[model samples]
Target: MNSLFPILAIVRKDISVWLRQPTSIAATVLPAIAFMVILYFGAQAVGRNPVALVVQDSGPHAQELINILSDSGAFKVTMITIAPQKAEDALRQVKVAAVITIPSNFDAAYNAKKPDPVTIHINNLNLDFTNDLRRSLPAAITKFYADQSAINGNNSPIQIRVKETDLRSQDIDLLRFELVPNLVLLLTTAGIVNAGLATAREWEDSTIKELLLAPISKATIITGKLLSGWITTLLIAAVVLVVGAASGYLRPAGTIYWISTLVIVLLIALASAGLGVAIGAASHRFQRVTAIGIPLSIDLFFLSGGITVAAFLPTWLQTIAHFVPTFYGTHALQMAIFYSSNEGLILDLSVLGATAILAGVLGVLSLRKSMLA
Candidate 1:
């Protein structure tokens, strides 16, 4: 009861001070909105990528394939009537993201009921473009082949049916769906920077001596700071959720989803607040803390695979990502918001739990030493 009183008092006082500073609230909320807007618009602008259509087969079936590619609206099909060697040259010169070739015997194979192969030569320079080609080209082919098969009376020997079972049945916009996990990561960053700065600010203002003279253990003081930071982050997260829902970037799933999200957010807040405390205690100056904290937050977020897909990264980078807490934090948020199931939820929560424990203990120890010195 003795230590608890001071901890609660500190938390309340800190929250009161934080609310009075309007810039702090704006600093936390504005960046999250900006990132969501940038990502949403960037995804929209990536459509209609340029692709080379090298037609060697002058058959009706070949023309049908060409028409399908052009009509899909996924690509800007540049019809290239050059030889295969020149087609390769165009790819090397970066004229297009990929080249789909129709062989000379395309109609002959179709007429004889034999297998016909459409060649796709892609520039592997951009993974995002490559992924687009890999997915869209096959979908176009599937649509065309299905239409052709229906016209031919369904006498085919083998029929493959592709069924996609989506985990989320809600009619949420894809851009909005993709933005949720990213928003979680951004909230974590805000939590860390502001919390870390709060501690550093105390040192810069020479207020540590007052805390040292107080009749309270350093652990209780650190606990107060951590709780204050975590509470502030949750408040910021509420703002983020409200803004995202209002902007149509997020939809409330249900009680379970909100519960799970709140849990993950709490864990992330604890871990990030701990890290911020540690960094602040180590730096002891607001300027040094910001210099180190901002870059550190960006690096951790990148490693977390919040903004970019991690599978396309180098093997070494992926390996490094497994050790970071945000990776699991982002993963947990995705599972809660999009999956609506507890698949791998235990493992994700466990990693974050352990991280919070370790970081919080280390932060307390660091602050203890600083105050005693």
Candidate 2:
């Protein structure tokens, strides 16, 4: 009880100091929320993009393809009966996201069983817009064939039947689910940098030297600092979760899902706090902490697949990322919230738990050594 008093006192003191500064809370939480808003608007823009549909064939087959595009609802189709050059001009002027040109021989080639080509001219300035066109156009073509086959009672030579099964039992918004996990990693990175900066501030203000003279053990002091950081990170994570929930991005599987998520978040916070403390102990200046913390946080985020899809990374980088704590943290949250099964959950949790313990030990030892010197 006697030894615990110092740790408790330090925690209270740190919390009080943090609560007095509203700017700090704003700095930590607002940007995360703002990013969520940006994602929501970006999704909306992607959903309803307009495309130019240039129809050179007036035959029933050609008109059927154009009708298929209009009915798909993935795009707003503008039928351009004018010259293909005018359609290309529309694309260049950004009046449409893409231009789809149906050849004059489209119906003739279908009847004669010859090759027919449909041209699509699109601005590749935005990769997302171009990709959307690529996907939607093919799906429209498939639908046209299916519709024709259904109408003509098997007279059409080509027939395609699609059997769709979800990887999970329930439906998930692919874009929202993918981006929300990245937001969790962003929150963790912010926690690490914030904690490191706060710890370095004590040295900058000469208060850490005074702390060295206190009767409490250095271990207790270090634990107290980590505890304060852990608490702050947990609060920030709560805000992020709330934002995710409000955005309709996160779906709760059950109470256990949330409970497990919270546990993983706490472990991540502990690891981040430990890393921050180690950086603070090594660098006595706040500038050094900022310099080290920001880049280090970015690297961790990149390794954790927050910047890009993990499967797309190089083989060596993918191997290296396996050792990164945030990788496990992000994976754990993704499995808990997005996936229906507990596949890989135990492995992810074990890695995070081990990382927290290892980092905490090193951070405490480093801080004790720095302060005692």
Candidate 3:
């Protein structure tokens, strides 16, 4: 027990020294803010947006759907009385998201209680808008008839507005939602630069020999090195949290949401740091560790749905996501942000804890072998 004391001292000292470097905080924060808040919105306007709307059939059912879409605040819907050929130019130039073309038989089919053959000419690039239109249009058709029956003698149809409360704020911005997990994954890998390089750097600087000569067990030496990595990562993550708050990624609306995000990030960082040290110890060659560490971390990102949503994914994909640390990391972040989701926080922490334990044990073993050899 006394032997463990010296190693803990060294770990504390290393963290203290690293924090004294003024630029340490900057390295962790700027990327997360820039990628999440800046770059994404900068180029968003260049993507295809809405302007033109075409209606071949002037029926209450079709127009009611358009009104619902117009109210969404997502698009600026303009009435286009022009030919489809004229609308094609704007769609091609990406000025319009889609042409809401109504079939001449639209009202006839509705009155006859048959399926309408309305065609919506959409540019494949605007999948988000296209999907929204797809769902809204069908719903509007159902609502139109429901309302018409509600009225006494008028042929006019009424539209139904389903008030979907975005309990998680995910609906507000899909782009922003996608950006957070990548930031988490990137931060996790960034930890490797700080954590993986710690022991290797001490050896190159000729400090490890002095550390080993001190009154400490080999386990203490490993403990100190791992703690140094973990603490530095925590500091970096702290800066990241502040930056996320300042940049509006972490909002007051989801207090519990943000808390979960923080817990998940810390847990993943702990697991990630252990994995980083394992790379350093097993390879023994510092350059090789740096070379291999990033790619392996990236694999976790891909497996975790870092670039996409895990919800629509196949069940097999969901199964695969569990083994990756970022799977729990990103999923938990999303739940906190959008749904105020807190159901599985404990389970996520457990998975992350298991990862940290396994990776940490492996890391300690590798460090001991490398140091003693």
**Most accurate candidate by TM-score:** 2
Model 2 misplaced regions, further than 4 Å: 47-49, 73-86, 112-114, 125-132
Q: Tens digits of per-residue lDDT for model 2 on 144-246?
A: 8788788988865555577898776765444565564566565566656767766777788899977788898877889888888788788888888887777
lDDT of 3 at 87: 81
Candidates ranked, most accurate by TM-score first: 2, 1, 3
lDDT of 3 by residue, 279-364 (tens): 77666556876787778777777777766677677899988877676777777676676567676878778887787888788888
lDDT of 3: 0.69
Better of 1 and 3 by TM-score: 1
Q: Candidate 1 lDDT, tens digit per residue, 1-373?
A: 8999989977887788788899878887787778777867866645667777778888888888888898886788765664777777778888877888889999999889798888898887777778888888888888787878787878544489778886555544445555755665666676677778778877988887887778988878899988887888888788777876676555446888778788888888888788788888888887877788778777877887755666567899999998888888877777777667677889999998998888788778877777777
Clashes of 2: 0
The all-Cα superposition gives candidate 3 an RMSD in Å to the true structure of: 4.9
> Each model's TM-score, in the order given?
0.75, 0.90, 0.74
lDDT of the candidates, in the order given: 0.78, 0.78, 0.69
> Positional deviation of 174 in candidate 1, in angstroms?
7.6
TM-score of 2: 0.90
Q: How much does candidate 1 score in TM-score?
A: 0.75
Clashes of each: 0, 0, 2
Q: Which stretches of candidate 1 lie over 4 Å from their true place?
A: 1-5, 45-67, 70-73, 76-127, 134-142, 155-181, 215-219, 310-318
In angstroms, give how far residue 33 of model 2 lies from its true place.
0.7
